[model samples]
Target: MTEAAFIDIDWAGRPVRIEYQWIARDRAAAPLIVFLHEGLGSVAMWKDFPQRLCIATGCRGLVYSRPGYGRSTPRAAEEAWGLDFMHRQAQEVLPALLEALGIDATRDKPWLLGHSDGASIALLYAASYPQRIAGAIVLAPHILVEDLSVSSIEKVRAAYLETDLRQRLARHHDDPDSAFWGWNDIWLKPAFRHWSIEAEISAIRCPLLAVQGLDDEYGTLAQIHGIARRAAQTELFELADCGHSPHRDQPERLITAITAFIQQQPHGDKP
Candidate 1:
C-alpha cells in the first residue's frame, strides 16, 4: 500500500486537482483495475473493496474522485449538470484522469469496476473507448433512469431535508452539498426521468458483468437486464436480499464475482 497522491490536471480548459491511490503488486509489471465511484461516492466511500479486489486478482488499482465529489474541486454553484453528465464523465473526466496518472489507455486496457452512477460511467466509457477496456463489473448500473429511480431519489431528497441523511453523507465528501445536490437534483428532475444510455451501450465490445441487488431501492433488475440486452458479451448477477450497494451489501460475493469475471476474460492478467 502507498500513500495517496494529489495531482493537478487540466480539464475542459480549467485546472482540476485529483486525488488518487494506486496499488501495484508487481512494480515491474501489472494490469490495472480502475475503480469508479457511485453517485454520492468518493475514494473514501469505496472503503477497502478496491484493495481487496486488487489483492485477489494481483493487479494494480486506480481509485480517484470525480470533479465534484470527494477531495476534487467542487462544481461551480451556477453550473447545472446536463442529462449528459455521465457521458461527460466517461468521455472527459475519465480520460483526463487516466492521462494525468500516466495510465496508457491503449497499451493497458484496464478492467473497470464501477458502482451505481459509476457503473453507468463504466458502460459509457467502454462504449466510447471499447478497445481500451479489458473487462467490466458494474453494480447497480442504470442504462435508463426509470420511475422507480426518480421515486427513490425523491425519497432521498426528503430524507436529506427532513432527517440526518445529510450529516451521514457529510462524512464522505468535503462538500456534502456538492455531492448530494449534484446527484439528487439531477435524478429528481423531470427531464432526467427519461435519461437513458441504451443507445450508447450497444457499442461496448468488452466482456461485461452486470450485478444488481434484489432489494435495490434506487434501481431495479431491469437495469442489468437492459445492459445484457445491448452488449453481446454481458453476464448478469442478482444478489438476494442485497440493496443498491452490492460491494457493501455483500463484499465477499462481489469480490468472488469480479474475480471470476476477470479470470474468464482472456485479456486480463491471471490471478
Candidate 2:
C-alpha cells in the first residue's frame, strides 16, 4: 500500500486546504469511501482506521478535516458557529470538498462513514441530497439534543481544562482549544437546545446503518433507535463497554459492521 498524500484542496469559497489522504485501488473502477470525522476529530485522530477499512473493503478512501481540524486551517476566534453549524457542514463544506477533489456527487455517489457529530452531518447530507449518496454508516449520531448531551459536554469542558485531555488532544490538533471549544461551546449553548433533525431522517432514502455504545455517556440509545424508527431498512448495532467514540473504543466491531453493511447493500443508482 502506498502512503496517502497529505495534500491540500480548496473548499467552501475560502482558501480552505485539507489533508487529502487517498489511495486508488483501481483507477478504472473502485468505489469511493469518504470518512467524516467527529466534531473534535481530525485526519490524524482517525489514526489508521481509514487505511485499514480501505484495505479490508478493497475501495479507495478520502479522509480530511473540516476546516478547523488537523492540518486544515483553524477556526476564527470570533467566528461563533450558528445553530446550523452542522447543517453548513452538510450543505456547503462537504460538497465543496468533493468537487475540489473531482468526486462527482451526481454520477459517482460515495459511501459516507461518519462518527458522532460527523455521523449527524452524514445523515443531514444524505437526507438533503438523497440522490448523491450511495449509503451511510452513522455511529453514535444525535437526532435531537438531550440533557445528557449537555451534561456530558459540560464534563468535557472540565476535563479539558483540569486534566490530561488537553495534552491528549494536543497530539491531533495544532490548536486543541480551537477544536475543543468550538464544538463544546455550541453544543452547550442554551439557545442550541432546540437543535433537532429527526424531521429530516425520514427524507434519507439511502441504506443506513446506525451504531451506538451501550455505555455511551453523551446520549441514550434513543439516538440510534430514532433513526431506525424513521428508516425501516436501517440496522442498529450496540457494543457493550464502549463510550462515545466507537471507532476508537471498539474499532474491530465498528469495522466489521461497516464492512458487512457495505457488502450487503445492493449497488445501483441512488434512490
Candidate 3:
C-alpha cells in the first residue's frame, strides 16, 4: 500500500508545498529508494511503478512532485527558469525536502531512481552529496545538452501549440503550462546549450547504473557513456526497443535489472 502526504517547505524565500507518497511503509528497516519523476512527470503520473519497484526489492519508496508540477505549487507564469534549474533542484530543493521529512541520508543512505530530467538531477545530487547516497539508477539521463534534445523539445513546443499536448498534460499537472514551459523554455534557451555536468559527475564515488534506450529521441547513448567515462563505477544498459522512458516502455526488464543491481550492492541485504 502507498500513503500520500504533503510537506510545507521554504524555497527561494517562499512557502511551497510538496506532495509525496510512501510505498512499503511497513518495511521500516528496509533501504529507502527515492523516485525522481521526468520533466513533465508528477507523483500521480508515475502511476504504480514506484510501489511495484519497492515491493519487488523489499525497500521503502518515496515519490514526490517538484515545486512546479502535479499537486504541488505551480510556478509563476511570468517567472522564467534559468539554465541551472536542474542544478538548483538537486543542490537546494532535494536537501531541504529530505531535512523537512526528517530523512537523515548519512544514517539511512537512500538509493535514487530518476528518469529523464529527473535522472540528470539525480546525477547532480549524487555528485554533490557523494557520501549521502548508497547508489543511483538513472534512466535516460542527460549529462549535457545535445542537438537531438533541443530538436525534440522543439517538436514538443509545436505540439503544445498545435496539438493536444497541453490538454493531455493537464491530466497530470495542476497548471500544465507551468510544467511544460518551465522545462521546454529552459532546454530551448541558447545559453542552455552549454549546460553540462560531465565534470562534476567525477566527484561521485557511489555505484551507479545508467540506462538509456537505443532509440531515445531526446538523447543518445553518449549520455550514459559519458557518465561511465567520468564515473568509473557506472554500469550502462542500452535497451533496443525502448525510448526515453524505460519504466513505461520496458517496465519488467527495468525492474529485473534494478533488483539485481540493488542486490549486488554492498548494502544489498534486505532489512
Judged by lDDT, which candidate is best?
A: 3
Runs in model 2 deviating more than 4 A are 1-13, 25-28, 268-271
Candidate 1 local accuracy as lDDT?
Answer: 0.87
List clashing residue pairs in candidate 3: none
Q: Which residue pairs overlap in candidate 2's backbone?
A: none
Query: Best TM-score goes to which candidate?
Result: 3
Put the candidates in TM-score order, highest first.
3, 1, 2
Write the residue-wise lDDT of candidate 1 on 89-191 in tens digits.
9999999888987778898788888999999999999999988888788999999988888888888889999999888887877788888898888888889
lDDT of 2 by residue, 1-271 (tens): 3443444555555576666577564543666888899988988888888888876776778888887777677888887888999999899889988887788989888889899999999999999999999889998898999999899889889999899998898898887877988899999889999999999999999989999999988888999999999988899999998999888899888888788888777752111
- Better-scoring candidate (lDDT), 1 or 2: 1
Q: How many clashes show up per model?
A: 0, 0, 0
TM-score of 2: 0.93
- Tell me the whole-model lDDT of each prediction, alpha carbons only: 0.87, 0.84, 0.92
Q: Could you give the candidate ranking by lDDT, starting with the highest? A: 3, 1, 2
**Per-residue lDDT tens digits of candidate 3, residues 1-271?**
5566899989989999999998887788999999999999999999989988987888999999998999899999998999889999999899889999999999989999999999999999999998899999999999999999999999999999999999999998889999999999998989999999999999999989999999999999999999999999999988989999899899999999999999899868677
Off by over 4 Å in 1: 25-28
Worst 10 residues of 2 by lDDT: 1-10
